[model samples]
Every structure is written in C-alpha cells, then in structure tokens.
Target: MKNKQLTFFLMAALFLIPMQVKAEQVNLYAAGSLRAALGDVAKAFEAEIGNQVATEFGPSGLLRQRIEQGEAAHVFASANMEHPQNLVGQGQKGPVALFTRNNLCALAQPGQTVTTATLLDVMLDPAVRVGTSTPKADPSGDYAFELFGKADQLKSGSTAILTAKALLLTGGPDSPKAPEGRNLYAWVMDEQKADVFLTYCTNAVLAKKELSGLQIISIAPELSVGADYGLLVLDGASQEAWRLALFILSPEGQKILGDYGFVVGGLPAKP
Candidate 1:
C-alpha cells in the first residue's frame, strides 16, 4: 500500500510539473498597430510551444520611451526600425528583424464618399472629419505631420483647412494632454467616429472585416516612408523572452505577419 501510494504521488508530481512549466508566461511589448496580427501569432505560439505570451500594445515611440525609462519588458517589437536600432545602440543587443512594412493610408467610415485627391481635399471637406495621433509622441503622428507639411508645400492656400482638420482629428476623450492619442487611430476606424484617419496598412488589413464600411486610400508621393516592425530581446531578458523573440522573428513568425498584411523583411533596413 505504501509503495502504491508513493507511485501515485510521483505520477501526480510529474503531471503537475509540466503543467506549471507550461503556465510560464513571456511578456511582449508591441506597437498598437500590430495587435491583430500578433494576436494570431501569440495564439499559435502558445499552442505549439506550450507557453503563455502576455502582450502590451502601444505606439512604438511610447514603447521606446518606456524601455529607455527602464521599463521591464522581455521582448520589444517596434513599429519602426529606428526604435529597435535605438534600443540596440543603447546596448540592448539582439536580432532586429523587419517583420513588416506599412504605408500611410487615409481611412474613412463606411458610406462616406470622398476622393482624397489632395491632402487639402481630405482636410477641407467639411463632410470628412479627420483624426490622427499627436506627431510629437507617435511616429504615425509624425508621419501624418510630414504628410501635412508636404500638402502645405504643394497646396499653400489650404492652410486653414489643414488647421481645422488638425483640430477635428486631434484627440479622443482618453487622449493624454501632452501627446494626445497617437494610437487611437484604430479606435476611430473601428467605431466609425471619424470620417478619415491616417493609419498603417497592416491596421487597415486587420480591420478589413470589421470595418466593412470603411475605405483605405493611398497617400500620394508615397510619403517616401513606411513603418517597419522590429523585434529585440532586451539586455537582461529571461530565456522565455529570448525564445518568444526568436519565435516571433522566425520564418513562421514572418509568415504570420504576412498573413496580417505586414510586409516582412528578413533584416532591418539601413536608415
């Protein structure tokens, strides 16, 4: 009876050990734009590797600021290559893979008919209310500003229209006072609150189903800019974090990113 009891206890221990191990969670920080695509990858990764991945999503610029301020995140994914490189330059060394590339797009609510021939056209149309993140805090916002600058140069007389557009798109209720809402572009897209918003191509792809009433229009002159998703393991990340980062930049990871409409590049581009 004693021998039988001991064996049963041993069996139970063995079962519980792996269960506990599987329950270990890795923390990942990603840009808000990557929420949909990463959700799929996280689900698949957990199933395949038997590990849990907890994700924090936000603007890449904000994530960089957090890391610089000594925030505790194991894996970091940035919306731009520059942020990851900045992290690496600051001595956080790891593989920086360009998991995706996104262009600027103007998204409008469903049934909102507007041909955005010029940035002025997009801004001036009283029927088209615009929204965007604060350029000072978010790269998307910065890009939006660049778009406006270019527009202002091309169409000088439309400054008031652009100013009005800025006011219209400036903030949501949850926006912070300083930087405002840099990542809320998707919320506007999802809720149909604003007629137009500037957001990433990947975001548009992910929301294509839910935002059936919205349309994505390309920005002319290409803005000569694109957002690249990059992954890095911080200086003192755990083994699990390293593994998660590795898995995210792997071919399997790139494939998942592609499925979400991200243009995955094998290596980070030269600035």
Candidate 2:
C-alpha cells in the first residue's frame, strides 16, 4: 500500500510539471494594419501550441525602429519588405519571407466623387485635401508615393503635384491619435482631417466598416502600387518564435489574412 501511494503521488507530480512547462511566452511585434487579423491568428496559435503570445502593433517602420533600438522582439511582421530586409542587413539572419501583399486605395469621405477612372483628377483638385501616412515611417505612405509616381506617367507633373500637396496625416510622430479602439483612417475621416485619404485597401475596408458611408475606391491598375509584407525571426529567438512565423505562412494563417483582404497569392498549399 505504501509503495502504491508513492507511485500515485509521483504520477500526479509529473502531470503537474508538464502543465507548468507547457505555456511559453512569445513576443510578437507586427504592423498596425494586421491588428484584427493577427489578433485572431494569435488566439488560434495559442490554442494549438498552448503558448501565450504577447503582441504589440504599430506602424511597421516604427516597430522596425524599436526592434533596431533593442526592444527584444522575438518575431517582426512588417508591412513592407524593406524594413525587415534592413534588419537582415544589420545581421538579424533572415531570408525575410514575403508573407502577404496589400494594394493602395482611396478612402474618401461621404459625398466625395472619386473613382478609379478619375482618382487622379480629384486628388489633384486644389480644393481637395489628400491625406497620406508619413513616408519612411509607414509603408502605406511609400506605396501612396509610388502611386503618385505612376500618376506622373499617366499625367505629366502629377508626381510633383500630388507629393507636394499630400498631407502627412497618419503614421507620423505628430499625427493625430485615434481614440481607443477606433480605426485610424475612420477616425481621421470622421474628424474631417482629410477629404480623401490614400491608404491600404485593408485599411480602407476596415475604415468603411467602422464608419458607414465612407467610400473605398480602387486605384486604377495603371497607377496602383502593391505592398509586400515581410516576416522575420530574429537570430537567437526561441523556437516558439520560429513556429509562429511558420504558422503565419501556413494555409490557416494565409486564410485569416485573406479574410482580412490581404493578397494571399503564392501561399503554401494546405497540408
């Protein structure tokens, strides 16, 4: 009887030890645009792996700066390849996988007459306010500027005109802060910060969802720019960090991103 009781106690202790060791903390820094989608993805990942994911979201460029300044992020998901690639150049040991893609769109307030066909004309109108994120601090801004460059090809001097007139509204250090749980683009438009805002299609979609009557107009193919999102796992990161990266590239992860309106082309096959 004594021997049997000792064996049962040992088994109970073993079970409790596995339970205590099962959950590890994963530090994830990701683009602000990915908040909704990644929030769900993190929940799913946690359920599957029994690991806790501590997430932080902000402009991809700003997040990259934080990581470079030694903020101790295990995984970094950027809205553009350039920022993560810059980390690779800094000896972060990366192949910098392209995890998702986004496209530029015009988020116009209600009553604005803008369409793919006449986006350039409306943006160039002197009375119209065109808002964009801060370039070098947000990939959305870079893509918007790229769109402006494309516009120049369609209409002479468009790049100079648009760039000069574009308002650095969001993603800047001094940009107006959105209220808690508010969509930045939606809040900006609601506040009449800009008559027309150039942002990601995903952002525009969420903004429109948050603020009814907002218009999401696709940029004409001739003047459109694609944003390539990159995922990187820094050197010396825990295995959980690498696991999270792979999970993001997995079919399940790709589906979540697709549902959020990101381009999931060239993703891995479902297993």
Q: Which candidate is the best by lDDT?
A: 2
Clashes of each: 1, 0
Candidate 1, poorest ten consecutive residues by summed lDDT = 170-179
What is the lDDT, from 0 to 100, of the residue 49 in candidate 1?
A: 84
Q: For each candidate, what is the lDDT?
A: 0.70, 0.91
lDDT by residue (tens digit), candidate 2, 1-271: 9999999999998887845456568999999889999888999899998889999998889999999899989999999999999999988889899999988899998999888898899999999999999999988998889888888788899999999999999997677789998999999999999999999999999999999999999888899899999999988888999999988888888899999999996566668
In angstroms, give how far residue 131 of model 1 lies from its true place: 1.1
- Which residue runs does candidate 1 get wrong by more than 4 Å? 1-24, 89-91, 116-120, 125-128, 157-164, 167-193, 222-224, 266-271
Evaluated against the true structure, the overall lDDT of model 1 is 0.70
Q: How does each model score on TM-score?
A: 0.74, 0.91
Q: How many clashing residue pairs, candidate 2? A: 0
